[model samples]
Target: MIKQDAASRTIEAIHESVRTYLKQGLTNEQIIEKLKEENLEPYYIETVIDNIYKEYEDKKNLKNAILTGSILVIVGLVINMLSYRLSENMNSSAFLLFWGIVVTGIVTIIRGMILYRS
Candidate 1:
């Protein structure tokens, strides 16, 4: 039986090889040659490709979320600032700021829920 560490190492090697092939858009035969040059087993390339694709998708989703949240936060800040100028009274300004914060929180929570549910 293969030791767990050794199996993990082999999988990592395969994963790296798959990433290389994807980056280079290489054929399976070419990928095998590349792996051979690196002294890695090429037979596991398909498994690696599958794993890498899933990893890429996960990373992409995370990146998109960060970008969306950042944009929304910036927009919320701008809205809060502008609301102060639009309101003449101090109480109105304070209320606008409070509502702006509440809106931002709600939007962020909704985004989190949507992402988590999916």
Candidate 2:
């Protein structure tokens, strides 16, 4: 029980320190040196760094994707409306293409939300 408690605290400490260093915008090498000084195992340090970096990148990418998807949807709609107004003879084929673009954007947004949640 005592060993488990110690291990848990160690893990928490490592996570906290890593997050702090990340927030400070320290480089990877500086973070590694600081972790080594804290007497953390090399393996734990590497794993934590990789995990944290991946997590942050995933979230960042997800946000960008969602924004891009929304933009695509809006642009598709605006173009469709303008085409309809400016060219009264906008044919079925053109409408279908615009709808396809909107659908693609919606699908992209849904996928991004799923990834962000997970």
Candidate 3:
């Protein structure tokens, strides 16, 4: 039991190391190189690295999508406001484009949130 406990702790430590390296903004190659010194099986290292990196990338992408979406929505609203202020009867095509930007932003944010949750 003692041996098993020690081994489990060691495994957890290794996993934590991977996360730490990732948080430090190390490149994938750098992380892999660091892991290579741990005497782990190549496949094990590859699997762990891939899974962690994928999660990180997904999170990053989701954040970017939400931010980009929000900016687009704000820009659309501002443009719409300015257009109306300048001319009460704005061009239909211009309004259409602004509305489209807002819709696209909404879709992007929704998709990002959904994908992150899943």
Candidate 4:
């Protein structure tokens, strides 16, 4: 039982290390080497690194999507307000385009928020 407990704790520590190293932008090779130095099995090291990379990619995509969506919404609102104030003789097509931009921006923002929350 003691051996089992020690082993579990060690594994947990390794997982924490993996997370920290990934956040520090360590490459797979470097992570693997560090894990090896800790005497972790090669298979476990590879698996952990792969999982971390997948997680990192997911987080990065979520952040990028959120930023892009926010920018689009802000830009759309600014353009719409400017056009409305500046142009008294705006045509129907221009109006449609302005509204379209606003709608698209709103949709993107909603999508990004959903992704981030999930």
Cα RMSD for candidates in order: 5.0, 4.0, 5.4, 4.9
For model 1, the stretches where C-alpha displacement exceeds 4 angstroms are 27-44, 88-95, 98-118
> What tens-digit string does per-residue lDDT give for candidate 4 at 10-29?
87788889999888988878
TM-score (all chains, Cα) for each model? 0.62, 0.71, 0.63, 0.61
Which scores better on lDDT, 1 or 4? 4
Whichever of 1 and 2 has more lDDT, that candidate is: 2
Candidate 3 on 9-107: residue-level lDDT in tens? Answer: 987787788899888988767877888887777677677778777888899999999999999999989887877665656534343336988999999
Ranking by lDDT: 2, 3, 4, 1
Off by over 4 Å in 4: 1-12, 22-27, 36-39, 88-97, 116-118
Model 2 residue 106 CA deviation (Å) reads 0.9
lDDT of each: 0.68, 0.84, 0.83, 0.77
Model 2, span 1-70: residue lDDT tens: 9999999998888888888999999987889898898787777788998888888899998998899899
Measured by TM-score, how close is model 3 to the native structure? 0.63
Model 4, global lDDT: 0.77
* Pairs of residues at least 3 apart in sequence or in different chains that clash in candidate 4: none
Best TM-score goes to which candidate?
2
Please provide, for model 1 over 1-118, each residue's C-alpha lDDT reduced to its tens digit, 9 standing for 90 to 100: 5699898897776777578778988876777677778776665565566667777886677667666666766777777777786675555535366455546655765675577456
